[model samples]
Target: MAVMTSQALWDFGRGSGVVALVLLTLSMVLGIATRSGRPAPWLPRFAVAETHRNTSLLATVFLVLHVGLLLFDPYAQLRIFDLVFPFVGNYRPFWQGLGTVALDLMIALVVTSLLRTRIGLRTWRGIHWAAYGLWPIALVHALGTGTDSFSAWFLVLAIVCVAAVLGALGWRLSARFTERRAVAPTMEVRV
Candidate 1:
């Protein structure tokens, strides 16, 4: 019987991490688009919101798998403590810590979202804001800790993710501005 090395597990962890990140990016993009009430040719706003929710749940699963694989991989040297606490990992502490922070944020968002009704809208929304902060932390963690961080494919993926988020943000801001402008004229003195 041939024995599999931890390297294989490490690779699986990395691949899943990438998938999780991509799914997260897609979820965020769809969420922002849904909020803007912009309907794509193929999908309605409700569909986009549904897709966003589904993608986020999927990302959560993959992220859990990613963390599990890494924690079990001997080469990763990741302790259980490292999963929740930031800046405590023995290897590449800063990068691993960033991942931990992202994980924490993800957990908060998921928990609050799931219990949104019980928690109340204001509280849920407050915690859910952490989801927005998770993206950059996860991105930095991936870039700093992954072996393929400097690879062309990873660079390309990073660019695409960044662009997607920035585009969504721009759209959201522009929509708010347009709404304000429309209301501004209405609010002006009417004789």
Candidate 2:
């Protein structure tokens, strides 16, 4: 097998990062939808939950590839330390640091999820809330450090991801409010 070129690694790294973001967005939207405890138009509730879990796992895999490729690519100038400690890298430290923070959160989420049976639902849920913060940090890191951030296609992809997450969040909130109102006791006054 021919050795991989630096350019190949760079390109692969970028592609993996983009794929991870898309998967992350999908996971986020499905997670929000799952909370409603309702089946999607076509998929059952269990299927939606399974899809959410699978997408999240796939995103994590792509993220690992993205970071691994960048670490090997001399152009990225990323060290293992940079991957763990936030904002210490020589290249675009702040932006890279954001990625580190997101990674840490992802680790926490995955660990907690894996141990959910041992840790119990309340603890797992509290840690899982980090997912809400992870997507945007990863997005900002991509925009700040990504080579294609200004390119038309990347911009469009970013916009669509943002819109999808925001739409899901809005829907979740509205559904919660509607549910609460429906269940609230009404005061009956006869004067």
Candidate 3:
């Protein structure tokens, strides 16, 4: 593990990681908002989509910063390459690889999002759906590699994040089922 300096507390890279956390939270919230149910035909779908893109891009930016700080933090004995490559980091290969996987997913999300307009909607949506997987991998990495991983304060924070994610997912799935049920009756009547 690398040594920590009191003066190193305010490094830009660390700041970036904090910024990333804030962006990720906002992104998750916005994702839930847009995914809850179908908006009216007059609703501004483009705005919701743009907000989603901006939040995702912002989160990606912070992910880069988080990786930068982690490599230099010294406490984790990570290298710059470890940030990009999975499963080959010097310390805690199994857990550290989680971070690498998360990073790669983040990068993939960004790339796919940037090309979303060029790609067809279905293809874009399919690739973007992978963010769900990336989100939990990231949470796991934080629990395993983060400096405050097991701290009481961080524990509460992690719990809240996890709960929010699960609750949102549940709400969305329930809403989908309700919509399907409602439509099924209408279709049967038409038949």
Q: Tell me the TM-score of each prediction against the true structure.
A: 0.89, 0.90, 0.75
Please, what are the lDDT tens digits per residue for candidate 2 over residues 75-119?
889999998999999889999999999999999999999999999
* Per-residue lDDT of candidate 1, residues 1-191 (tens digit): 11276777889999999999999999888877776666567997668778989999999999999999998888889999998789999889999999999999999889889999999999987787777889889999999999999999999999999999999889788745332111234455779
Alpha-carbon runs more than 4 Å astray in model 3? 1-19, 36-48, 175-191
Order candidates by lDDT, high to low: 2, 1, 3
Which clashing pairs does model 3 show? Answer: 2-74
Give lDDT tens digits, candidate 3, residues 1-191: 12345226325554565456656666775676575444425556456646766987888878876676666665557787887778898878877899788778878777877788899789988887777888888778777866667889777877887778777678777745333111343444553
Instruction: Flag regions of model 2 displaced more than 4 Å.
Output: 1-4, 175-191
Question: Between prediction 2 and prediction 3, which has the larger TM-score?
Answer: 2
Deviation from native of the Cα of residue 2 in model 1, angstroms: 8.0
Models, CA RMSD each = 5.4, 6.0, 6.2
Clash count for each candidate, listed in order shown: 0, 0, 1
Clashes in model 1: which pairs?
none
Task: Give, for candidate 1, the lowest lDDT window spanning 10 residues.
Answer: 177-186
TM-score of 2: 0.90
